[model samples]
Target: MNSETWQNLLHLESRDIVSNWFEKIHNRKLSARRAKEIISSARQGREYFRSASTASFAVRPLLAFYGVASLCRSLTLLHRWDAGEEGLKQGHGLETVAWSATLSGDLHLALASIYKLRIRTCGGLFSDLVTVTNSRTVWHVYDRAVPMPVDNKKQKLGQELCFLDILERLPDIGNTVSGGGNQKWIRLDDFIYSSEFGAEISVHGTPDHPVCIEYADAGFDLSKRNDPYNSSAEITVLKADENLFRKYLPQLIDTRVIRTMGGQPSPHLVSKFPQGSWFSQISITYMVSFIIGMLARYFPTHWSALMGGEKGDAIWPQINAAQMYIETALPELILEIVGNSIFDNKEL
Candidate 1:
């Protein structure tokens, strides 16, 4: 792709769009221009994102996405790792697990919008990486040719931040964690908070501009996620593309945190995101919907064909089962167990 194409892909005015949305809806000061640059890029990525079919199959994208980012220092990859195909596939619990999962794209967008990265590709030298995105320029390194880490970071070129590229590591976070080790997220913020829960995202400097990026909390909840496979699996992302804050997330909506505590051994412990799960599920589902909808339009009809021995007439049962697992049953179980634990701990 040419620079023009790359511009179209990466320079979408999503920030402006989202900022404007907030300005209009909440009457808050915001920059809609940021969202504008990445909308098209996000759409383009959707093409590859939804190509993933099953829960277990989605892990590749999820892990690979984050694996690419080194700045995401603390990640519970193993805590969230899926151990079995049954857990990855047969268990209808991934959607629940992914509720807190965040995408790196959101963080990247925030980083990129806040700070721009200059990508350069050179032969043999990692600093001069052979970036294929746009700049069709190849060259010898200004500095002596030095081997670079297999990772995507062009350290030689002074590219330090690692928020955005990480999402490319895993396809579906829930799959990776509960449903068998996949990674995914929708609504960019979901990615941010999930990736850096209780952790601070420290941004040191910017180009030409002397501004520093600060967040009260780098974490955004994955309550809303776009899941398209099953309607019951459908969950919406909170503040999907809305211009939240250039610096800090405004209100203290300890929703999912509450939910997390709810499922804890003690109620006093208090979950972090009571409402985040729903929001994460919704947004993630929305993203999945967009991907599935887009792909369904182009994919052969055979792709939609049911492989199950069960009759299509019994689809309602499947739908109900999905809802029970994703919506009602799972939530009830989570709350029944963790809610009390959270409350008890909080009291203590």
Candidate 2:
């Protein structure tokens, strides 16, 4: 996280600032009692993040996950005030139904043999948050030729999801989770808007490698505009008039608007997966953190072995990346969600 924004969040530790911020977002008469809870919850969440920053990777996930949970509680308070404190008391709304580790005669092999971990949604705080953000999928990150929502509406609660599959969907660590393959998120170099050709917006590919941006909607022309500098690079440009561009303006904005700690935004075009197989970035964060925290808390022997055993070298980098995401990216995401909920312009 940037130092300036981190300091700004620290300032919210002041009760007066939090209270004022809360009231400002609502722009209405405030509830003194609820205001106190929101202040306390946000403080608690920040402290957890602070503590997580100091801890070693061995135990960091636990602290970080709880910190995220606390922040989510604060957001929940802001969004679902009708539920009140009683709603905040609900369970995590997620569970690890089955996790199996295969054993070999060699201790190192046994330690490395964590075969599978699966979790199910049990309808609690986490589930509620997922439902609220379900509309914003990986599909929303692009303009596909066939613009159909991935049909996840019928996705049943309590249906188990492979822990690795969900972990593989994280925008940052996904490549690591996929055995060092291509990134699930393709970061765009630029989105150039031109009015010369009736307001044409070009989706530039990452300059470092060749990319094929395809399946644009009808009336939007897709031409092979490869980068002249790199013979192998493919740049997909979508052409549309000002009116048509306005139709996709919301999605285009969302695709580019990943805010940093100081409210600096970057553009990353995401890849789409099958319906019910993909999730929004926030849900992925919460679910992954929850799984790691649960493992650290409940499976002490295995967790310790996984951290220090033979495969540790390979796994530690991903673990460290997860921690970094929790520390830096997670807060920005929470702020974004809360800001959107309150219709606030700024995310502090």
In order of appearance, the predictions have TM-scores of 0.19, 0.69
Candidate 2 Cα misplacement greater than 4 A, ranges: 1-3, 11-27, 100-115, 131-156, 174-176, 180-183, 189-222, 226-232, 237-266, 311-313, 341-348
Tell me which residue pairs clash in candidate 2. Answer: none
Instruction: Point to the candidate with the largest TM-score.
Output: 2
Residue range 57-124, candidate 1, lDDT tens digits: 22322322221111010011101122211222221111211111221244323222211111221222
lDDT of 2 by residue, 215-322 (tens): 253245556476776788766665666555434331222221234445444444444333324455566678778877877777666677777755533555556566
Q: What TM value does model 1 have?
A: 0.19
User: lDDT (CA) for every model shown?
Assistant: 0.23, 0.56
Model 2 worst lDDT run, 10 consecutive residues: 139-148
* Global fold similarity of model 2 (TM-score): 0.69
